[model samples]
Target: MDKPVLPLTYEQIDHWIASLQPELAREGFTHAVGILRGGAWPATLVSHATGAVPAFLRYERATRTAVWDSSVPLPARGSKVLVCEDIAGAGHTLADCVSFLREQGLVVKTLTVVFDDLSRMRPDYGMDCRGYFALLPWERHAYTDRYRARWQHTQAGTLGPIGEDHEFAVYAIDLDGVLLPDVPPHRYDADLMAALEERDALLPFEHLPQIDFSRTQAIVTGRPEIDRARTADWLARHGYAHLRLVMRDPSRHGEHPEQVAAYKAEAALELACTHFIESDPVQAIFIAQHAPLLRVVWWDAARRAAKLIATQAWRGADAPTP
Candidate 1:
């Protein structure tokens, strides 16, 4: 059994911060000390909201050392300070930082965006996000295998493998019809080189799907890997350079719809994506059939609507006409 992930958006964070403002403003905090990196976002926002002098402390997880950032002047002894962190999990960072601040004779009240039941130190203020693996938008790259390997190297002895322990909202999308117009097959049949040139020239659709590209983990395309250069160029030109592009193998080029769907299903599984958005209804259905647990959405470009495929049963006859 895996812990379900709660994908958090910036809007949700903003809302959480907003909800904290009135209470934080009432606290009359003199200084805001943000834990470096993740904590900085909330701490800076809290400072702006409460008029607290901002400071930071960088904590080295491996060394269990907390060092105040010398660039920002430390809060005066006896001054009331509000310490902020992104999360207070089963980690010592928050506890240690609070202790360090208290030892300096500063009055400290802890704050965090989220804290679980197993947290080492419960903050005075934070949302109770127990049970779920709270995935933040800023740390989206943590879903990668490399990051997991790093985590295993550093903390796996205590925390276990992140993938097996937690479910994540990794998303995959189709490239051609979803991001841009699909180059008509007839165009390619007529003139392969000219069609490739036309595809390379085609701009992203004027009205694209309502997907948050920030959360889109990969672009799975039926286009052969031979078009990698042009596909990459188009993606980069359209401000999606950061996304991973998975193309059909050159050996499997010109595969039929069933083969293409198989390739997509395999890619989705390989990537461990939880959801997939596809442009073709048939492909979407096939993907859902192959990966029953995955949430597949069919994007109807012409209708400007997205339909969720709830059942794995094939309903090609019911599929909307292109």
Candidate 2:
């Protein structure tokens, strides 16, 4: 069999991830292992998806044709491991990793990649995102430009989808208000992230139960690890109880802020996401160059709850933008 040509920028990876979360959570695993660097980020994402904390596996193959060669290997204990890589091309490295683990007497429950390239081989778990190979050229563009005053929404599996170029289920959401809260809300700067924690504090387990955290394969953001860590931690602490993942923003994903929403949206749409949430009312044109993401304006939980209290989902779509 021949290996498919998928790029590292494919968007379907998110879709694959979103679709895979529920399965991962339903069949809970013990520990998650990351491939390092690229794999680390995906591990964080998977962690967020599965709500499981992951450990790093220090291994460097140096070449695709060679066997596993690294100073660090999996632990000696027999753990239900979910090994991850940033993007996969066939199952060469993963196969080697599995073999190595087996040799040491370990159990690997699942082998997944943020991006899976099935041109030739396949991993036990992951989305089949193939568009990455075709859009490699533009896949690079996802980070090149900004909003540019035009509304662009990615479907979550195409911009620069990485992996074997397969299809998987996905959840699409307009970030900003949904994940990061579009604006700070007040002069004090909403500390949007702080608000996230605040909101989580109010809820029994944050607001995780309110939304489908298990289906969240990815949460696109322009924020750096430092800014995202606080809120991400909160999610991990309460929302994502235990699902292995690496939830750090990649330099590439965060490069273009203006276009970030659209790029992410585009990928989300492709995966036929379950839902989307966003708000640009608080931002200037410079911030939300492309406004009016969806039909219903975004509102805070208080307002949203108020609307439901007074009426029903029949009036849910037209909620206020405050």
Candidate 3:
């Protein structure tokens, strides 16, 4: 199945920039350098965030060489320079720049907007690419014509829009119970991992037919972030790795395990999820309050189709339960 082309907005980019500020500071980078085209904006944002001098570095990918063509010279030797780029796939170009910068005697660290899961080079900081493809905000224009036509076709003959107030909405699905067999939390073990690894060991819920995983924009789960890699691997093996996988940050809510709904709700709101297919009934209720713009649907175990919990229904309480 073809992967969905997710479009990003400037708001999301600002979130990335704000989130990366402190991490960049800890690395002690004195300068920020961007690779041509895609890298320029992110590098500038990081520089502004970190109070580092912003500069540009060009890479000749065909020759795998880093070129220093700016009229101004690079930072002095021993200066910490953070190399920035939009995305790193195979990372050959990034690796070449790192090598060249080091050869020039500059301290080099790296940052990228996103990185492929199986990428050869891992940046010091990066967001993992959930899907096989990404359409960055800067690159959105190039794909607009194609994406618009495809989106229109996909929405045709369906409801007016997909999201709460939009002309179309994106789906958000849960993994446990909905996609895979549900093992009690206490019973989730290595055996489950082995089964997931085998691909056929797991089965989709009986009621919900085999779904086109590509349709889901986000997998909002209550699992902790520490399991991200393991969860991603399982999803990838099952051909569902392209969608964004959201896990709870244990450190932030160490005392509130019951607030899983809050975590899922916040993620759904941030990711602009319009329709949600969840397994947990309590979470479905909480999600309705937090994600007012989202239409919540519970995957009823005994039902033929998903159960719509609420749509634009205002409920009391927006605060996360303590």
Candidate 4:
């Protein structure tokens, strides 16, 4: 099953950081040590808020090591310091960093943007984000398979598996008009077999949507399942074979716009996809209506733009027509 995702916006992160200011001031920290990469942002903010000297430590996750920056000389022994991190997952980075700081005789208190209940090292202060995969605004690419593989590699022999249930954004995208030029319905109606063959031969669209194929989990298409072989071949040839393809069931539904929309909506729900991108505006509206919680985006192929279709406005009888 796909993990549930908690998309964190800048406003939300700023608010979280702001909430820590009062306590940070009370702690009377002399220095704010940020773990590099993810931790640096929050550490800088903490420094700004608490008027503490900002310091950095480069942490290597794979090697489980932390090295202090050469320019920032070590703080005097016994000085109060707050270590900041973005998130405290089941990792050894925080523990190792804190241990290294304490070894210098500095008083170390850990702070993180978020920490799960199952985290190996709970921060002295953090937003309890148990069970959800918190997607940070700056590190949107962190959820990709490659990133996960790296995480898994470093986490081997750890407490729990990374694939365990957690919240994460799952994206489902349309194929025909979104990924490639759509063979007009008229052409398909005129010569179904010939149009199918032509579509199979056509290359991907030049100005496709700015979707990260690595993060995209599924492709929900209106094409019938009988065409899976050709569809899979097309996707593989175009370097998108890793994505799971959900094709229309010819035995259950016809090629009507409404039927197609329903099929796509059902597929999105079954896949637990948080976002669905469709090329047809009408179908986009229909899918949003069917799955009110699902985020739907209408991809304009010509303009190469994506417009989010809000489902709330389409909920009641007073809903505006598309």
Candidate 5:
């Protein structure tokens, strides 16, 4: 349970694509097939940096429950398949993709991305520059039927550019200002916390008693590892069993130390999260691909736990107006 899921700043992780370009050329991946959606952006960055324009593939989500929709339009033959994902947690998706590529007879020689932690199998090439280390919720956070029973956004509309299909919303604040309370467990706002408590299902946990969390996600970042841990632990106790700690292990990828810092983006994208919260303005300013669609929340109060602020504001659709 002592997971080291670390959060990464966008600025701290944006340089990974350029750094990994040399690996692509060395691997002879002239035409690369990037998995769709999440992989598209990183693939684009890689293409721009390496001048490999037509070197990306767009894979779709699996329609089947058993199989992940890696709808990749791979070349019928085979070249150097670089399966890219935001985070390499457990390698479930990564491994699936590798197998999928191989089935097509397309030689998947290397796996490249911002973060590659061998949750299962090892990638031909590992470049985790973003020292950002956190447990991906989908992979670690507990799920439950009760949590799913409360549907925030039904699969009724389009994900658009924001990826609304993931059924997640954004709530952001600063570490030094908004998240820290006047007390010791000062990561969450005391007042807002009371609001969160009103609905226990919202707390991070797996296995909803009656509902299915087929599509729901969350993304949060703190100043340092300790602050993040404090908030994370508090949430877990309060009913956030679904909170995943993105742990950063140095031994995992010895080849690309620089990539360790860039893996934060992987964490953000792993949960299929479209929104984010942050205190540092610079964190989102530098990174080109990971910016935008980002809503910056200036911490009105600093509480590590939860505060009873305007609950309806954060909860949006359901939070009471009290």
Candidate 6:
């Protein structure tokens, strides 16, 4: 049986942070270092509570080393530093971070919300974890991106090869916000390109409960064709493989944002799937307007909620006149 996913709320995080007050009440800590993206929020919370200066320790995947960003100077000699992470699953990240801090000649302490039983490295403080995957409030974007099953009887299985007359419900899904959290558009710069090239970022989003990959007919995404390799790797790692993925052909349409909507609408119309789950509200609305016969379900990443947008069964008479 698949393990049930436990979604942790902000209130739960606040409670856990409160529980660690007794352990962190000591007076010697000079700085609180966050382990980049995942650790930033909790570290900030700890810093706010304890009055410690906040800093970042970024992990370089290519080098497999954790180093301070140099923007923030290391603490004074013999100063105590508290490190925070959202979880200590597999123990690799925190372990590497602690080793890096120790090498810098600073006293180090670790804090994590969830501690996996199988992790080789134990944290200085952690809450008891009870699920295969713990979705932190900060990671809620992922939970919202997953396809929630409305048809429970649909068994999980792979979509057979295309061009065959397969008699199964096909769901056309948007990639970024629907199946995985989309990277913030503002961060599309040289740094983002570097991260992609390093293969250290763009990790796969965890699927929510009731999501069966076999139900996916085709993934129509706005991501450029250049990202095909990394996107494929991420999908395969997350158990989505051998399915038709339609990405924007930048060579033909260029990177005009408007072209993305047109491409997606074209794919949805061509597939004529039973449903299309989309993350972008505007795109979802566009799909509903263009493909009135197709049901559109909206996955709100910000609110972590799902809503049925539009649905109209198509008849042969309703075919578009070209």
Best by TM-score: 4
Worst 10 residues of 4 by lDDT: 158-167
Model 6's alpha-carbon lDDT is 0.69
Clash totals, every prediction? 0, 68, 6, 5, 87, 1
Better of 1 and 2 by TM-score: 1
lDDT of 4: 0.82
Which has the greatest lDDT? 4
- List the candidates' TM-scores in order: 0.56, 0.37, 0.45, 0.59, 0.41, 0.46
* Angstrom error at residue 213, model 4: 6.6
User: Residues 196-223, candidate 6, lDDT per residue (tens digit)?
Assistant: 6444245545554234557667898888
lDDT (Cα, tens digit) per residue for candidate 2, span 1-322? 1333333333355656777788888766555666654466566667788866676655544443323233444455675667776546544666666666666666775455533445344666755566543222222222212321111332232343233211222333334455433335462264765765564444231232144545554554444456655646655765543433233255644545445544544443333332333343322222222322211223354344311111012236678755
How do all the candidates rank in terms of lDDT, highest first?
Answer: 4, 1, 3, 6, 2, 5
Clashing pairs in 4: 3-168, 4-167, 4-168, 5-167, 5-168
Ranked by lDDT, the better of candidates 4 and 6 is: 4
Error of 6 at 140 (Å): 3.9
lDDT, candidate 5, at 289: 32
Candidate 6: where are CA atoms >4 Å away?
Answer: 141-322
Candidate 3's C-alpha runs over 4 A off are 141-322
Which TM-score value belongs to model 3?
0.45
Q: Model 2: which ten-residue window has the lowest total lDDT?
A: 305-314
User: For candidate 1, lDDT tens digit of each residue in 62-126?
Assistant: 77889898476777798889988988968899988988989998899998888876788889988
Q: Model 4 segments beyond 4 Å from truth?
A: 1-4, 61-64, 138-150, 157-172, 179-217, 221-244, 247-300, 303-322
True lDDT of residue 60, candidate 2: 46
Candidate order, TM-score descending = 4, 1, 6, 3, 5, 2
How far is each candidate from the true structure, as Cα RMSD in Å? Answer: 12.2, 18.8, 16.7, 7.7, 16.0, 20.3
CA-lDDT, candidates in order: 0.81, 0.46, 0.70, 0.82, 0.42, 0.69
Better of 3 and 5 by lDDT: 3
